[model samples]
Target: MEKIDNIKNEINYYLNKEENVKEEWIEENHPIDIAEALSELDASEINDFTKLLETEDLADIFEESEKDLQIDILKCKSSEEIIEIFSHMAADDITDILGLLPIQKRKELLRHMKQDDALVVKNLLGYDRESAGGIMTTEYLLLSKNLTTTEALNKIKKIAPDTEIIDTIFVADSNKKLVGSVDLRDILSSDDEKKLEELMDDNIIKVSADVDQEIVAQQVAKYDLTVIPVINKSGILIGIITVDDIIDVIEAENTEDLYKMHGVDEEESSDTTLLQSIKSRMPWMFINLATAFLATFTVAMFEDVIAQVAALAAAMPIVAGMGGNAGTQTLSIVIRGIALGEIDFKDNWTLLFKEAMVGVINGAATGLVTGLILYLMYGNYYLGLIIFLAMILNLLVAGMFGFLIPLFLQSLGIDPALASAIFLTTVTDVFGFFVFLGLARGFIVYLI
Candidate 1:
């Protein structure tokens, strides 16, 4: 704690210094640590520090920082300076930074950039920000089929510094359409006189520039590719999405899912302004409040039954709360499975059946204990029987709704994680309360 506080203090001191700090100090500190320190500073202070660093250094820092903080810094920089920094940054990094920027600012930055760079950024921005084009780097080594191994090597040497990676080179047709690929190892090992076409692998798995980023990550993992080529609709090679970029995509996607599960917008980052955080969270909280009231209303409907048999009221929350918990467990697993592409819509019924079976097993175990406890406490077999039946039924319902609600929401093109929790919990609560109260009422005379 003390060490963290010292780091925070030092960061604040440096941020407010209003003088250029030593480059050596900046270089010696870990980029991640510096980013964390910067995160603690105000946006304007971050902007000042960003301007003080070289474009390359700034790009590195920007990439290391959180996405929202990156946007904050971008918002503070001038359009021309932002363009210059983006121009010198890696294509993947530029794409990521641009993704967080406002559309108007992004367009303005593109307008100020070099035509080729601007075209690449514009093409990337054209796709869904969560797609292959948006995450891919436009920097890659390209060779022609006509080139000899020696010629290709020379071309690689000329462009190696400018390209992201020369280890994997793509071979394109005369019209710049991707034809095949060859690794640098094969090129170096082969005869200098051999044509690039002779050494190419035609089975290169390529993703369309507009392909979903999650799909791109899946393909990369499936093929165990180090670098996957990105092509336009016409099959003209535009760029390559590297494994590193895919890793970032995966992490971002996982984080988004986590946020969504908690009823917060996935776009809300830790670095988001307090106002932005409130905006993102308030709607969900309000929705949750409404759903909570619905649960309260369900309980209220049985107020007379509860007033007569106060024990029912005392035990009601336990059944409903347990069902809610079980339902959430099922919901979480299903949602994560869907995000990871492990679950398919075609297999929805199978998943539902599986969850139902799990529910039966869990419900039986939970019901037995509750039934025994009620019988021992009240000495009323009818009350125990009612509680047991209600527990089993509620658990089964919990499982069913938990599995189906997310699937139903997803089918409607809604985010399953965002609204599924409220819906599932409400179902469990209402049904649990209704079953417990209705059974008690039906057996009311026997109990008296």
Candidate 2:
């Protein structure tokens, strides 16, 4: 609370003209800080404050803001000022914001941009939003293989303004095909006469433009690359995906999986309207209510068993609840392994056996304790034995469904993280209730 108030206070001080928000202030503070402040300001104040900010600074703050907030900030700026800000921003980010606008508005916004800049964004907008071409930037420095070390250094200085990072320079042939790459140190260490072809290293890792963003992130992570070049189907370098873009992709994916795991829409934000949140959540809640009926119907099938021995009613829920928790634990591990690409079909047999043994061993241990407790409380040895068998059966069933559900979902081309939990819960709850109640009904005389 204190930190937030302090930031707000600082921003307000500048807004009221009590203190000047200098370039030094913008440079010292983070862009996210400015965005948060802007998010808190009223429409009039937002328009007033944006006029004082430099185009690049305004662009940086917008880049760090949420999509809705970015649109709001843009509404505060004039068309000319907005185009100036776009000129200072990355094409990928500009296209992302523009893509969210109405088609007519999007076309008008692009029409205002420089012809070359607009063309680059138009080409980029053609790619899928989750593809390598979607996230890459055309702003990269490329060197001709024929240039000498000294000549390449001069070319880099000339083109550095348009480049994002020059630490690793990509070298191309006369046909504009990527041949090799070299570190900036490779140029500085070599003699002035050494050509780029002689200094560049081979065996580069590159992704095609059409490849999925997730696969692009994985390759970057696997190879520990700072920037990966994106090539066309014809093997010509078009754009580059930087480490920052991969980081964003990883964060977005994790957020999506997290939301889907718990039955929330990934696109819903903290500022989502209350009615919108309800609309988004209502369908899933209804689905969950229907699943609850499945458990209730299973219990209904053995109502006679529960009526005869009231003690069975007390113990039945314990059995089902335990199975549900156990299934969740196993599926958590399996789901993570699937997302990280750690699980393989070759090791799947081993994995299934391991989980099954875990179920047996854990079931025996837990069943023994729970059965002993029931026996002590109810003073019925037959009741204890019945529960012990039921528990073991349910737990083994839990492990089987938990292990298989995610794989089945994946095979069907569905996200395991989204649907596996719902299926796993239904399996555990239905089977857990059925096994415990059916066994009690069979040994009703002893249970009495």
Candidate 3:
């Protein structure tokens, strides 16, 4: 932590210095590390630093930084400067950055860009940010299907400097609609007399521009493609979603799931301003607080019982707290399974049976320990029996609900992570208290 703080201080100090640094010194560091160092700097300082670098270099730095920070730097720069940066950046990077900007700003930026660049960015921005279109690069090598292998190679050579790579060259018809893809290796090995149609793999796995990015990532991993083409509704090739962009999509999605499972809002970021963080989290905290009061109110219903058997108050919390922890464990698993597409609605019964089995095993183990402790501490077998029964029952309910609630919410078109934790915990707490007290009333009359 101390080392991190010192690094931050050093970066900030350099940013604050009025004098310019040598370009040689900046070039010595990796772009990603430089971007990280610049991340903590003020927007004005970032803008100044950006102006010093070439457009391509600046775009590389912007792409390396966090999405939100990229927006901050773009906001500080002028439209012309932004357009210059956009023109040089890979299409996918431009799309990701554009998605982070407000709608009005995005339009203004689009208006200022060159027509061809603007059209590509506009096409990308049309799709959901988490879709294939938004994550794909419009930088691909393309050749007419009529071209011979040698002709294709010549075309690739002519465009290689401006294009991203020649790993996979797309063959298109006269209308520029995608026909198939040819691997660079196959093209090199093929006779010059062969046409692109002869060398191309017609059974290409392509994604619609509007296909969800998660689904696109799945397809890429499923097919092990180095590049997946993105086409419009009319089957016109628009862009290519590369493995690198898909990696970012997967990481973002996993991060969102992890945060949501912890009852944290998906939008809350460590780099977010304090006010922004508070704004994102305040709603969830408020909702949790309200649900907590409901749990407290349920406990209050048995105040008379608790008063008579003061030991009930002590033991009741143990049952409720344990159930809550167990439920959270199951909740984390189910939520992640859903996000990763590992668990589906069809697997509901399977998950239910598995959780139930876990509940039985865990409850039996926990109950025996609690029962033994209660018998020893209170010198009453009846009280121990009541506690044991209540614990096992509550844990069973916790496990069942933990797996079911998220599945239920998803079916209803609500986000499972929104308040599933609060709801699940509330159920367990209220039910745990009621069962413990009610069971004690019936089975342990002498204790009461």
lDDT against the true structure, each candidate:
0.82, 0.86, 0.81
Tens-place lDDT per residue, model 2, 1-448, is 4655676777777778844468998887788877876788787777777777778888898888877778887777777888988988888888888888888878888899999999999999999999999999999989999999999999999998888898989999999999989999989999999999998987899999999898898899889999999999878889999999999999998898888878889989888899989998888888888898999999999988898999988998878887888888888888878767777445687888788778877888888999999999989998888878877888888887888888888878899888777888888889989988888888988877
Question: What ordering of candidates by TM-score runs from best to worst?
Answer: 2, 3, 1
Candidate 2 local accuracy as lDDT?
0.86
Off by over 4 Å in 2: 1-3, 18-20, 344-347
Instruction: For candidate 3, write residues 287-334 as lDDT tens digits.
Output: 888988987888888777888887887888888998898898898899
TM-scores for every candidate against the unseen true structure: 0.86, 0.94, 0.86
1 or 3, which is superior by TM-score? 3
Per-residue alpha-carbon lDDT of model 1 for 17-112, expressed as tens digits? 856666787777767777777887787778777766777777677778876677788778788878777766776677667777678877788788
For model 3, how big is the CA root-mean-square deviation? 3.3
Backbone steric clashes in candidate 3, count: 0
Residue pairs whose backbone atoms clash in candidate 3: none
